[model samples]
Each structure stands twice: as C-alpha cells, then as structure tokens.
Target: MVNIALGASLSTVILTVPVMEAISLYTGQPFIMAMTSVQTVMVTITLIVAAINLNDGQTNAIEGMTHFVLFATFVMLTVLGL
Candidate 1:
C-alpha cells in the first residue's frame, strides 16, 4: 500500500507540474500559484487521511469505500472537466 501510494503521488507530481505549466503558459496565469494550490490540497487530504487511519493501523470497510468513492470521483471530475 505504501509503495502504491508513493508511486501514485510521484506520478501525480510529475504529471501535474508540466500540465499546470503548459496551462499557465497558454493562459498567461501564474504557474507557481496553480502548482501550489494543487500541492496544498493534495497534501492536506493526505495528512487528514493519514491522521484518521493512524490509530487503528488497519483500514476498515468504510475506509475502503471512502477511498474507492473518492478515487472514482476524482476520475469522473477529471474526465468531465470539473
């Protein structure tokens, strides 16, 4: 799980930075602002989930459901341009 999380996060950063930079270049927006906003949100959510799951050291069914739902929502939002 840790490996999976690490890989996913690394890929996100690798992909998002360039994409954000491209968007900024084309739109004349600040790249740093866009990158920072995305980084902050991702970090905040990761910290919150880590905190919530730290005590038990085990993921319950509800937690699994939450993760799945969140992932699905992310995919849909990305696809739909939310």
Candidate 2:
C-alpha cells in the first residue's frame, strides 16, 4: 500500500513542476503552477480527512464517501474554473 501510494503520487503529480518548467523554458512561455487555491484547499482538507479516517487503522464507506464527495466538489469547481 505504501509502495502503491508513493508510485502513484510520484508518477502523476510529483513531476509537474519540473516538467512544466522545462516546457516553459523550451517554449519561452510562462506556465502557472497548475494548482489553484481551491486545489490547495482540497488537498489540505483531504489530508485532514484522511488522517481522521485512518486514525484507527481502518476505513469505511463513510470515510470513502467523504473523500469522494470532496474530490467531486473539487473537480466541479475546477471544471468551472472557479
């Protein structure tokens, strides 16, 4: 589970900054960090919620649903660019 988490996080999100910087330099264009304030808040809240859910070394549908709902809200806000 730890390996899976690390692999998934590194593969998907960890390279964003360097890759985007390289692309910006190559193209001579500026690119934003790709994370909005809403994204930041979502991540913060997710971490808190994950801790709450995992504090007992187990998780359930309610905890999962909390995460899912938060993710959905984040996606909706992102899609609307708000």
Clashes of each: 0, 0
| Candidate 1 local distance difference test against the native | 0.71
Q: Write the per-residue lDDT of candidate 2 for residues 1-82, one digit (tens) a residue.
A: 9899989888767687688888999999988767988899888999999898999999889888999999999989889997
Candidate 1 local Cα displacement, residue 64, angstroms:
0.7
How well is each residue in 31-82 modelled by candidate 1, as lDDT tens digits?
A: 5553344445655775687678666788888887766766676566557655
Question: Residue 63 in model 1: shift from native, Å?
Answer: 0.7
All models, RMSD in angstroms: 6.6, 4.1
| Model 1 weakest 10-residue run by lDDT | 31-40
lDDT of 2 at 49: 93
Alpha-carbon shift of residue 39 in model 2 (angstroms): 1.4
- In candidate 1, position 59 carries an lDDT of 81
Candidate 1: regions farther than 4 A off: 1-43
Global lDDT of each model? 0.71, 0.88
